[model samples]
Target: MAGSAFFMACAILVLFGFCVEAELVQHTFKVSNMMVRRYCKNKTITVVNGEYPGPTITAHEGDSLAIQVINESPYNISIHWHGIFQRMTPWADGPNYITQCPITPGNSYTYKFNVVGQEGTLWWHAHVSVLRATVYGALIILPRAGVVGYPFPNPHKEETILLGEWWKADVITLQNRALASGSAFNISDAYTINGHLGDLYRCSNKHTHKLEVEQGKSYLLRIINAALNTQFFFKIAGHRLTVVAADASYTSPFSTDTIAIAPGPTIDALLHADSHPSNYYISALTYASSPAIPFDKAASPYASAPPSASPFDNTTTVAVLSYKSSPPSSSPPIMPPLPAFNDTPTAHHFYSNLTALHPNSVPLQIDQRMFVAFGLGLTPCSVNQPLCRGNAISASMNNISFSFPTTVSMLEAHFRKIRGVYTKDFPNRPLVAFDFSNPSVNNQGSFQLTDKGTKVKKLKYNETVEVVLQNTAVLAAENHPLHLHGYNFYVVAQGFGNYNKKEARKNYNLVNPQERNTIAVPVGGWAVIRFRADNPGLWIMHCHLDGHLSLGLAMVFEVGNGPTPSTTVPPPPQDYPTC
Candidate 1:
């Protein structure tokens, strides 16, 4: 679980010395169902290697990971490295039926990928269905040996803070029922820090997640928002966080009082630890929805209110950060200020202010420009379908809903010369145009129902592509955190309302823009991101909000082969799952 020290014994010249011989990380994850109590009730939940947050896989940059995943649970499973750019090894990029088929019940799959250029906080999670509710773990990659230290000074200590949601009932059971009764959903009763739901929840006061820290010593907090559908506002009552990195990429330091974290992006913030020698409250509250749009009570009660105002708002989890030599008391700690349920400006400012520590190496010249509008839509139901009592609510990108191919994986179909699995004809521009930010705009005319198909955009190697993602106000105008599979992109510009291309182009950050694998395109707003299509594979891009992803807010990037073998995709491994 530690990075091997730099030495001169096994250095090789094969790969330009960027990759010296480093110890490979080997771990076995046994996915099984276990009974656990949350909110004072015992319920069976899926777990990885018996741990709720599983085991944190630790390795240095340039080291490869060999994770043997053994499935003992009833559900089919696939693990996705959330922020890892799979680079040349797209086969290991786990998206069920995308990169590979699921590792079926009682079966196993070994995911092997090199952490070539990534560092800082990233994570791994089950990519199949709602099973990610309990099956996920942190994948922390340290800096490469003899290459780069952290841009900021090293902290006195580092701690991993995993933010998660805890549901009493199984999500699969709920999904089946939701299929029978369209749009009925339930959110977790409580939120969790690390693995405990803190003392605020019913019967959880005995075992709260707490941290004992030395006074006046700075510590780095690697905070991950693993809550399935809720982005969070995290803060400590008496401390300030100096933001350093997001999504495993280094950022120019900026200080913020309260940090808004989306579901998929990880934050690495430096806590100066300059507070009085007393216990401080570590609080995470729900950044659930934008209050501008009317709530959809018929769909789910999750959007009814922030957790603080709901009946279970008392379930607000709180972990204590105790200063050394401070007196211990069985009392509720003070809470910090949380953003209003609909503070888009605060959320926008937090994301907009971050920049990369260094200038980007990719050229800023745009080779391809794509404008894809995404949102929830409705498709007319076939005869007497229960799931579509009226119209089946769905999600889409560019007026096309992505359908999963059950026959084979996208990578296998592309590599083995199979046809009809997917088409490389995804639209570069949206099918309809309107005042996208107008909440009162009618969706019944142009963009209400969308065509469903398996489609992708084709890109050549090394082509720099810029995509302007505009969020539509069709059903619900909510923040969609888009996660790109195989590459990290620079989020150059984002703004409220419809995007003005000329104005957006003028304001784009061409130098030292913050790089991230996931970007939260604001509700009724637009975000422009640029990435080079250098990786050869069928990469899946989708909304990280699990519900939106299930509803088909996704697309694929089919990257063409390069002239050289190194740039071309390698053959699939022997253990790759077949349908």
Candidate 2:
């Protein structure tokens, strides 16, 4: 009997090897213009695979996937494989201005890379600035052989839900207007579930996407928050969701009735469908606060009125989480009791223990510290200045707008070196000073632009470093989603208001506090991160908000001295952008 069992095990191992060798798959997709009249209005918008929040591309671990992204739009475009480890695979990183030139209109580029890591929730999106607002989709990686379905029991069905923001106006025009006026330029009227804003308007009915699930069975729901600028709270009326993964990595499973997810974050949950058949709404609501308004105690003839209340109050339904009808004429499905936010003891303990296990893993360190200030206010222009002939309302980073360098050949070329025409006479300290809690500030603040913003702080190949990002309360009271390229970092510490230099030095989590590619700098707060500078390449560290980055809230870092000369790759091939 033991001999027979050994023979059966050997046969199973042979079959698995054969499957691994033969199961690799490759697919090519196109990014082109499609007529998607979202919200029932006959409007046209850019899309991937002729759909908003394009099709989900799935692959197993150890598989090589090739995607041929053809750009048929009237503008330049590029697709980034978000949250993937593209260390040596620079070509597939998809930074249009960095790794390669953009795929111009009527042009095509093939992105090929091996999926060499563990499997979890991943995604792809346009990485060329504003293009991501409209073009994004899910990239799911299934587990390798012999691994069980997930930490929890296998579900009856699985679904991929992507949340996106919709804009009816032209994206370029909307951006330009915001730049010129220096105010909120929200054109979106409704949030989208799988690309459709359901039942909000007459055209909403046409593009609705629905999920049909079975009653009394478990289901796996992979949720991706792909919205451009909104953080959301999600909950289903009749089911409890056990969150098992975050940011494409598995965490210890924690059950909750509601989950808060920020942009660029992904969460996977297991939902046990109700035994009795009943329809219920699966809702996602924005957690954004209203923009602050300047108060006027005395009313005048020309005083402006306050902005009206937003339509997205608590009662709005984001999506329906309905169970299929069953026999026996059942009553309403039972709802699980909600968990308190502070009661996330399992998550806290898991993250804390993980950090203890990996204590010496620091990624990026402070060879030199630079202070940057961001804020919005009215300021008088320099005499006969092109942009400031009068007092103009504006927003700035380090108190300066992004002026394209006239002498540079291109942004990518200029970013390759630490010292250049762009780095001349860099400032030693922040460019603005104001109260973060206050909505407005005085106009006498100083602003300057320097080449240091593009400079590279040198790192030995595979050296560990810790960076403390101090928020000095110099801008509006708002959280900034800080994103880094080339390497993911462990968030060692975070706190409200200015960073306590003494306290942070003693209690830093150098091991593990959730390694991530992007982190949130809290409103009126600071965050410290650690990363290993092992990947040799030019990388960007910037705010994820496209508008803020366009204004000047961005910088580049060049990690040099790799093992191979090919690490410093040449320029992209000619005819790169055919459009």
Candidate 3:
């Protein structure tokens, strides 16, 4: 007994020493912009840490993290830690206007915060509008100290596949043209895998991305779809992909030959590259839905076509999943088997159950319910208008285009606590809304273009709220991936066609609904979400589809009260830019 006790004491001492050593492992990384020649071409854009899609920063939960963002670009920039539970540290939440301001050109800001809370696959991106195109990266969080690894089986090899859209035109010029045209902007020439546009099989003098893998080896693929305004159906030739995780949450491993993902959605899949043939092409094609427009015939010029063009007609080649060079083969490359919706039990289970993998099991009734409609419309230019140079094609959430008021702070404070504050004042539901059948108007009012006001709902520190988003597929718009900052919500129900209130009420996944910070609002359909307003701060909720948000599909929510006497966030860092 005496000898055993001595051994135990030594083991405890060693464990304590290990804990002390772990503390020293915390890392501080600076995510900033540096000019890089993209596509091996002279075209330059500000990128994070000098790399497109930035660098992958990995750390375990509970580890200390210090990230300094220096804006070397000419534009103002800000980085938001997506899906991170910052607890009381709202300062590190990274809202451009709500939190500390953006980093100005030639300035730097260091964001210091501990990686508290759960461990999962998360990402970081620019908070400012449209800048995410160049400024984004992956942030993978491991388990906390003393905790076991993930519940599922771990793979031998892992790679991060960041999917993005690439445009040949200058980004600023493209944006300006789109704003002027008030129509679908630059359709990306190619989709990129990590940053390389595998110019199809026609690999010219340009460096094409080819993933070299050993034959018959299982590899984990962390896929992030960062497209601006498209959803993609991804599949690799001659291999089956087993999806095990999505949006930073673990799901039961389910096999699928092809999986569809939208912008802001991250999916983890295990690929068994063990095949007779060594090399294969991993293809990802856009799943084109109807363009965003009104349902009326007059809204679109191509509405009369017998068969309209599917959004997938144009595809961006992301990357090629290839094995090391093998013996020459006479047979053609084998394409991956297409997934049958009926055969896959997981698909049936997912739809029948209508629940998310990360269920929010909180038992709280919703105290308030809000209905929001997202669509695109046109506003006629007023005569002799200085701001309205011409007719403005715009997007709106609840029938309001975003405007920045001169008395921004006071208006922000008022909108933070009032529901329906702007509804009656800013009425003009867009043309798309009228094109949709049986358009419902809860409030009727109109606000001027000069009014820069926000719609806000006041909630206590911990209030349960439900938001129902109805997408009027008028004008044939694509789906929108809605994202909320600060809180994760339960996707209670989702489906095609219109949202039947009676059916939705019966099919609510209150028990095992997946909790997520972002969700895809299907085209011509509806999505219902429930969330607890626990985090006290001003949080922005917007479409993860960067294009839509830039056009004005976003709003802010102020939760709880401010600091006792004054609740406003501290002034931005000295180097922050007004632009």
Candidate 4:
């Protein structure tokens, strides 16, 4: 670990996307309690720097950042820089008990890392328990100062649109109740745009987030879906979005009336304000792919003007996109046509259509291949188990329910040779193969139960690996957004139904497939991703839905050290949190 003097003195000249001198940036986040009112209810929630959506962190490519988090709040917490390739600083890759223990209440920890290689929008959020419901903020990286221009024409300006969820009850309390009962958590009260609940709810029309734009000028919208579990369809009334990036990686620009964004990825789109100088509604609503789960009959009456169609936050959060020439009008703004809640085809088309902006040599040969079958499941209950009123609801991958270590972080255990914290015996494929995509198979005794343990898979450093993720229909069929912590992988192909090894290989897009840190496996379907295990550390891969993740839908990959020092993970920071 470097001292404050060295941190301030160390500077270097480098060329990555541009030539410039790299410097260290610093920020402080004080996690404290704040009282907020929404949907006619007042509640105290945990927040950073007392901001509802938290504070944004901005950096140029090649720059380093040192963010000190002061945990004044009553809960232990840690922050994860989503989509960042932590490089050699895996100790700073925050996921409670995975990378390091959470910073206890009144304690503090500084996250030091470098932003390199990638430039665009990413985000940071609490990775402990369920605090991410409110503890999230945007992380934006720009091209190095000396860069000439972006891949596409630079927009006249840029704006950050953070789509999120809001609840009337205390988030921690809500989660505890759900866990204690071994039942699904109650859905959110409403969805929000930049923390505003919009016109659909009471006392929100005046507080709705509004964006003013100039006619004929294009604006780069750095949109992030910070929702805990829901995927959203975002659109503006009379405007076309030219998507240029996903998960901070540039993509071939594609025009669309709407964008389908899952929980963990950030999207960059160019919005042209060419319509008549009038007010238009920019709306975001749940795109629920799980048709099997029934709708929430108790959904808040303030959710929307019309009833909700899905079980998840069946609400639309709105913002006004107004041209500079127009003022607030009494007439209602036009609403964009949103697909049905279970419009799987629309979601599929949006994901498969994206390709890399610049093609790179996608690995044609694989050194390792693995098939992972994952979904929700149930564990039979004993009369002694109080939490399991009937049967404990759970989820798993390859029939193994991931259990986290309580004494030390997984990375620490691997780094210091600590034993018994976890076992490197995670299965690469299902123990017993069956019809994974068939709804009827969910009734079978073999397919519905899962075993729990802290199991992981080991991989050789620098080995090219391919993983086929197949979503099962054990409990319900829903789109599972799986996020990998350490590296971005190429989403080569995706399709509905079981993945046929022989037939799926033929449809692989080896040339220009989209690269993403998070991929949403289609509901009752499968997707293929390929990447090289270059970074050394314990990297976690899990469903982005917090509920599913809590239910044990996750696993870890232990990538061993590489040949050279530059490719190896360094010693832990002196201030690394201890369990």
Candidate 5:
């Protein structure tokens, strides 16, 4: 990865033209199985370097990283740097079958790329299967060498908090069983803070994660949601959090009692330890937006009948925010009151209120306009099929469930001009246009079925694209966190009900809309984003919810090479994993 660059002091860094040359950081990850006891149950699960939420990788912006991963576990694996802009190095952008084939057991592959012009918090995770339930860690990028400080007031201390989900059964087996039986995967047994299931759960008191704070000092909390299938609401007992950045992009500072984050995005918030010295609860719980669905209680010990209508892991995970020099008291720590599990208003408020700290030039002219209706659907099952005895659950964009090619990676095929791997006929609009958000539309039989194929949309170099993501209510409408590889986009507008071009244009926040690599599309609603397609490569856009991703809510963007050698994507490296 080679390029020229300009550092930003008071400017928004665009993905195409800037690249800074800096340090070369390296790490070797050993993947293997480890036995861990949690909630009185012992289970052997895969881990990286024998650590649960593997080692954090820290580097300055504009640094190059060469991470060698040796897969010693029984399962094949690949690691994805969630929000890094892999400039001219799409082969290093890890995604099983999309960027490269998975490294098999006993095999090793080195991911080499440069982190150009990105700062603040992001993360890395397994891309092969549900293995990310345990194999993940944070990737923090600080400001470049000459930059004075953060865009906001610098905090006295920094902490990394990873929120995760846990299950007693092997996550791979659980997902395979659910797919084979045409049912939903079992709900998680419990949630974790820094990979510890705090004192709220059975047999977990001694291992609760604790953070000590001093009076009159502020701390920067780099919060990453690594949960496979749920969004979380994080709050402290009696403190306000000032959020400064998200998804490695800077945002205007704002104060909130609770922070709502879906999986695959990072939130950098400032916490002031101004309260009187005492023990405060740092808590997180599920914000399940999906409507009520049937849940099998036999699958998990923590599973119970929903006290209300919606089916969710209606449980809380807690950690202690202890004040230094405070006397130990017998009384319990003070807990914060969280929002309801289906509080869409609160989630929307937190998500939409954010604006970019430094405004960029949002493309005023659009070269490509797309309206993608995405959510869950179904496909008819074969009569003699051993798996999926009934209609198999499926998810899609524009009624097309994305199918992965087996023999070669999508990027490889695109680079080599290999035919028969995928078609460049992905629709700009859905094949069948109907009332997307109408609840009654779910009753239509044909509307619930979708076709599966490896179809991609083609884009010319440097084309500006605008996409309107509309969430559907076929099976159930929920908040789907849509993530795009290789670039960040401006979220211009979002609203409930159907998307009207004329009505939405009035509210487009083109001046300072939030810039993020991932955007949580409103539940049963719509969101619009715009970006310039300058990086020429095969990039995938998909839902961050692991279950929905496996069910096929994904699509690829095939960007053509630029006219000049400098702008074109380079060929793959020698050690690129082959199928």
Candidate 6:
């Protein structure tokens, strides 16, 4: 019931990460219409600064950034500095209708925030509706100048590999058309590596991408899974990588042949160029853990190519990881063996092996704890729905499907004490309890579909909170990479199957748990995370799967104001968009 709408963001931020504040970094982003060819077709898309993948924002830790966004595209949009802790500047924590309103066509707004207590690979992407499908860029944060260096040895060089998806159909058209029928989703025609769809599909050879590296030198590859829906198995044909960090937070180095990451996740790995200098293939394969048949059925057009065995389509997106001595060759580069599309063991191993190199103490006394359950399900189709055959696909957290605000942003409503913009009545525990891992249990009347609302969890500032995220098997249970905006939380424990709070708490690593903004909740499993809600703002926690998101698998956390002004979030920007 704490409501007071606001606009006009101020530049005051209490520095947290780096003690010494550096000069402000400024950039101008002009969102405009651009036409480009992909999937053997010329398509017009929304691009930032006229770049397909958009321009990268690079800065060291403790640096403030003021990005002026001029939306020239036809669609309304807002950019989010994903994985960056906005501190007191929640107005810059963009999520359409959550923090600020969208920057409408022909409108402009400036996002001002300082990167605090974070260093490593993060990203920026559109926060409005479905615009993020084509608008995202890397936001790299390096170690503060002269204070320290990476936990691993310095790489000879670093490379950014932005893994994304491509669609022949205009995203706006495809999404709107699908939504109007109540069945829009996150599947794409093809995937891309740094904006190039390689030789996997027909007429794509001309747009292939290749990364050149020197032999016997170590390289840092910042791997970002920016795909709207697809989680991926990323590998190099003949090399192994030592993972050093994830989601911009440092982790103890763990070596692996391939990395499995979901959307909104980033892995910073060190690759030792130890393989033969032949043109090695860098490949990405779809990781679909859902048990349900996919909605997409576009088959491989080439009959000569053998059929694939993996449930997630075996169509691989490729690029050459060429050594300086090796050039392109007709001889087929060896393909790295990828685990099956639903390989749970491999995915679990990669996630569980990670630990915080610099362990922070977890709170011994928890202020609030909740068993939050989430998954895909069905809902009664509206009269207008045609894509769904009377039953629309939906997602929910605790049997409640989240619906965004229409009249004002959550911040606006909360600030102005508006009556109905949102409700802090978000359930702390599952409303209808059942054996969460049993796929058959959801057949019951209440479990088959969920009710909908605009709900949020209210938290007292600086309160310690623990969440046991239990994934349900209501539908095709998939590995969901859950992302929380505003603050990075410590991942203390994760496991498969229904979470037994008493038993699970026994194995909790109160020490040395990795801190991250995103955690991949095991399919039909659970993960436990703890964080101190010191930052005052209305934050979002949701499944990063775009399809799941569209179906309403998300909620908000409204952290109350702190004792002092510096710890409190101020008003929104003056030019904030209106509905």
Top model number, lDDT: 5
Candidate 4 residue lDDT tens string, 300-415: 11111111122566788899888998776789887888778778888888988999998866888899889999998766553434665556668899999888888999999999
Model 3 C-alpha lDDT per residue in residues 384-484, reported as the tens digit of each score: 33444444545666666554322223223343443433332322233233433222211111211212245555666667788878775433344678888
Candidate 3 accuracy as lDDT = 0.62
TM-score of each: 0.93, 0.78, 0.80, 0.94, 0.93, 0.92
Per-residue alpha-carbon lDDT of candidate 6 for residues 236-321, written as tens digits (9 for 90 to 100): 98899999999998888998997989899899999999888888889998877666522212231111111111233357799878
How well does candidate 1 match the true structure in TM-score terms? 0.93
Question: How many clashes show up per model?
Answer: 0, 16, 18, 0, 0, 17
Q: What are the per-residue Cα lDDT tens digits for candidate 1 across 1-579?
A: 123323332244423444556778899999999988777888898899889888899898888889999999988999999988887889899999999999999999899889987899999999998888778889899987665578898899999999988877778887666545445246677889988888877788865888888877889999998878888888899888999999999998989988889888999999987777777789888775544444345443222222222322224667888888788776667777767756777888897899998888755688999999998776655453475565566789998988899989999999998999999999999877877777654323355677888999999998999999999887667788999999899998998899998888788888889999999998789899999998999999999878778778899999988999988999999988988
Which stretches of model 2 miss by more than 4 angstroms? 1-25, 145-149, 180-183, 200-207, 274-276, 290-317, 326-458, 471-475, 505-507, 564-579
TM-score of 5: 0.93
Error of 1 at 550 (Å): 0.7
The candidates, ranked best first by lDDT, are 5, 4, 6, 1, 3, 2
lDDT of each residue in 1-579, candidate 2, tens digit only: 999998788778745644345255666677777776665566666788787778788987767777888887887788888777666665567765555567777778887766765477878888775777778999998876543356567788888988877777777677666555443345356677887675544555555556667867888889987877665667787677877776666655677777766677677888887645665666666654333344342421111222212233232225555556744334433333433322323223322332322333454455544454543333444333353333333344454443333333223453355245344333434444445333332211332112113333455566666666544322234556677776677777776555667986687765446667776565556677777766665565666656555555555555655677645434434334322
Candidate 5 C-alpha error for residue 98, in Å? 0.5
RMSD in order of candidates: 4.6, 5.9, 6.0, 6.3, 5.3, 8.0
Give candidate 4's error at residue 253 in angstroms: 0.5
Q: How many residue pairs clash in model 2?
A: 16
| For model 5, the run of ten residues with the poorest summed lDDT | 299-308
* Cα lDDT, all candidates: 0.82, 0.59, 0.62, 0.87, 0.88, 0.83
Instruction: Report the C-alpha displacement of residue 533, candidate 3, in angstroms.
Output: 0.9
Candidates 3 and 6 compared: the better one by lDDT is 6
User: Which of the two candidates, 2 or 3, achieves a greater TM-score against the reference?
Assistant: 3
